[model samples]
Target: MKTKVQAGGVSQSPVIDIQDLSLVFKTADGPVNALHEISLTVQRGDFVSFIGPSGCGKTTLLRVIADLEQPTGGRIQVNGMSPHEARLARAYGYVFQAAALYPWRTIERNVALPLEIAGIGRDEQRRRVDQFLELVELQDFKKKFPWQLSGGMQQRASIARALCVRPELLLMDEPFGALDEIVRDHLNEQLLKLWLKTNKTIVFVTHSIPEAVFLSKRIVVMSPRPGRVIDIIDTNFPTQRTLDIRETPEFIEIAHRVREGLRSGHD
Candidate 1:
């Protein structure tokens, strides 16, 4: 059911509200608890990152929010609706770890795929594809196939495709985890600029603490197996941030705290 809670004597609602959410997988090895007692509230336009080791349920939680996976117990509301309902309404966009662009399709065609499926008009599809291509600085490469572009460019195309639907929430699962440090840094800067310009609520899942620290307003640290949130560390940095800010002591301190949180979770 939809939830609207009151706080500070005022009506405050969360864009994504998860309450005691638990998911168990019926594997051959028996029941595996992917997530247990997971609760989180993501306000509108908030940039939140979930960081944890492998098998820690970070990606699983993201998938749950996207309605790709169903929760075995408890409740989850996305944009004041059930996750399935919200997904059907196109309330959010998802970017996977891999670009997953079609090798046969041109970058522009790949970006236009969703619009085409949604029965958007030809002219409108062309307009949005062009607009988002430029948004991700890939307008010049639009005509090229995915195999023709560099890894970073391909990921940028994927991001542009995700934004084409104009969803309010962007759920990314380690989109740049495989890129080299230089390329990752560049994309991180571009992503921050894009986030600032669009003001969409983004929930990113990553294993890199530095990437989490640099991109998120709040970092959700998770434990290993049962994947519970051990800590939620808020950043003091301003929204208008550049890569140079990562070198500052403040940034390092936040990274250190995230590291400590992860360590404590392991303990």
Candidate 2:
């Protein structure tokens, strides 16, 4: 069931609404504060990137939004609904650093996994699977197993699987972090195309400055050691950005700004 919380009344009803989010883990030694009082608002159809150094709470924040982890303090609402409720409704699709595709499942079956869990009809699932494969330019690899594909191809399959269910929110945590620079560049371009085509709200976490700049409409820079939002930079780049756009002065300027944000967080 969809969330009952109304939008626009409280803080404009962000696709992701995080307020004073704090996380702590009690261990044998003492309490470990993983996230500080971090707050963010991600609007519908917005592509946002979270960039921070190691030990920062980028992934933890994403997990909280995905309902995989609970915050010790603060609240998160996805589409005006609680994260856990939204997760139960399958309101978002998640792609992790690794593709995480099952070894035994073929590409099509893997793509159809969510639909199967949602109890969608076979014919509808088949159609959606085929459609998303085509969207990711992997329609021909429908029967291929995960092992049969290269890292890039496997990530593509993972993306296809994530989109097969037509989720409104896409949570990607360093999906291309494992690929080489050249392959990562290629996938970045493809991801931009897919983002435009689908118009889904994307929350991507990455360490690469250029990658984050290229893929996001806005970059959310977080501080290390009790992570918090240090800065948010908007990239007013054209929607039809290409490889040549990366070399343009505008792109360099944005990258510089992001680098500055990252540096400021450490000081």
Candidate 3:
């Protein structure tokens, strides 16, 4: 899915491409615009974060990318195909804001649910479940149910389940938003490492400036209702960066720009 824009040669498509995208919801009272003229492109292996105030349509935009919500206007393509086609091709895995795990099933079984539905053999399912669980560092907890795990641990399990399908893209919607700061920081570190190892394109949704700065290669600052793209800020930090990088002036500078973009959009 990497962009192969060769010099004087044919160019490959970006991982995601959106052009003048818009969406409106039909409500009891009237039509409510959720997104307006949203245009952005994501390259393979890049990490992008969407951040905005509450009700700003960050999640709505993400859902559009996932094909969970259909757009009322404009166009979007995921991995050179329509979101519907890409989804059928298993081009991406989505981790929702909540863990959304079933307490009835053990961690391994939960992770295997998709594989099961795909009609994968038990042997291959076990292999993928084991592999992804180990990647998320949840191998030891494979036998535990969702209720038995801490919120962070359960979220990790949810991540493992998402990764088991070996998707080219990962869509995470505030996956750690509800966690304690200490735990969230730890997960951010781990997630960066995971991205480095897998080289998968990730589109994450978050409301935290620090979290977005820490994890994203590019941060898309969004406006209020009828969400518009206010600014797209790039973080040039190395992939191997630690949490300590947040203290650097470079990090703070970028965060300031993102904040200013938000404020200007409101104005």
Candidate 4:
């Protein structure tokens, strides 16, 4: 939907807009605050990374945007609609920490399952499955089961599945976190290329400073436990940068700031 701008112009509302958002979980031990007054706006095609300690609400916040978890306070709009509506509209695709692919299904079938559920025709499903698998460079692996692929390849297949839905936004929760350092770096590069190609608004959760700096256009540093945003650092590196960019002084400086922000959050 289009939105009216104040300057005699029309514009789209941010792909994701969140204001004073907070969530609490009720447990036997009492209430646990997961997020605190979180306010953020993600523009179209931006890649934003959230980084923090283990207990922070990174995944929780992502789930909130996905409408898998409800917020207790404040407001959030995904694709200019309530998260529930946005979810029903299939406004975004989520890649969780694991591949989460079914062992019984071939890679192509796993990627095509959602389309099948959505009632897409068989020919269309094959087209989308082939298209996305090629996008993720897994076209040849389509016949193999999840158990047959390497960890990194499995994650790539999961990403292809997410992209097959053709959502405008992508919510990724450490999709490469479990891979080896070399594999993680390679996937990070591939993911960057995919983001550039798709122009999808991506909100990624990561624990690595270098990964955050390397892949993000903006990095959101968060506090521990109660999960408040401590900083939002911008990166102006070329969109086509390679891992070598991480060795540059500018990248190092950004990494330092992210590190300091995490430290301040702990205090």
Cα RMSD (angstroms) for every candidate in the order listed = 3.9, 3.4, 2.4, 2.8
Clash count of each predicted structure: 0, 0, 0, 0
The TM-score values for the models, in the order shown, are: 0.95, 0.94, 0.95, 0.96
Candidate 2, residues 1-267, lDDT tens digits: the string is 122223336534689988899999788998878789988899877999999997788999999999998999998899789999999888899999999999999999999999999999999999999998998888999898999999999999999888887788999999999999999999999999988877788999999999999999999998787788889999888898887788999999989988898898898
What digit string (tens of lDDT, one per residue) describes model 4 on residues 93-139?
99999999999999999999888877999999999999999999999
Q: Ranking by TM-score, best first?
A: 4, 3, 1, 2
The CA lDDT of each predicted structure is 0.91, 0.90, 0.92, 0.92
Candidate 4's TM-score reads 0.96
- Candidate 3 worst ten-residue window by lDDT: 1-10
Q: Which ten residues in a row have the lowest lDDT in candidate 4?
A: 1-10
What is the overall TM-score of model 1 with all chains considered together?
0.95
Tens-digit lDDT track of model 3 for 1-267: 233323313234588999999999999989888899999999877899999997789999999999999999999999889999989888899999889999999999999998887788999999999999999999999999999999999999999999988898999999999999999999999999999888888999999999999999999999977789989998999878999999999999999998898888887
Model 3 alpha-carbon drift over 4 Å, by segment: 1-11
Residue pairs with backbone atoms closer than 3 Å in model 4 (clashes) = none
Off by over 4 Å in 4: 1-11
Residue-level lDDT of model 1, residues 1-267, one tens digit each, is 113233332225688999999999999999999999999999877899999998889999999999999999989999889999989888888999999999889999999988888899999999999999999999999999999999999999999999999998899999999899999989999999999888788999999988999999999999877879999999979878888888999999999999998998897
Deviation (Å) of 42 in candidate 1:
0.4
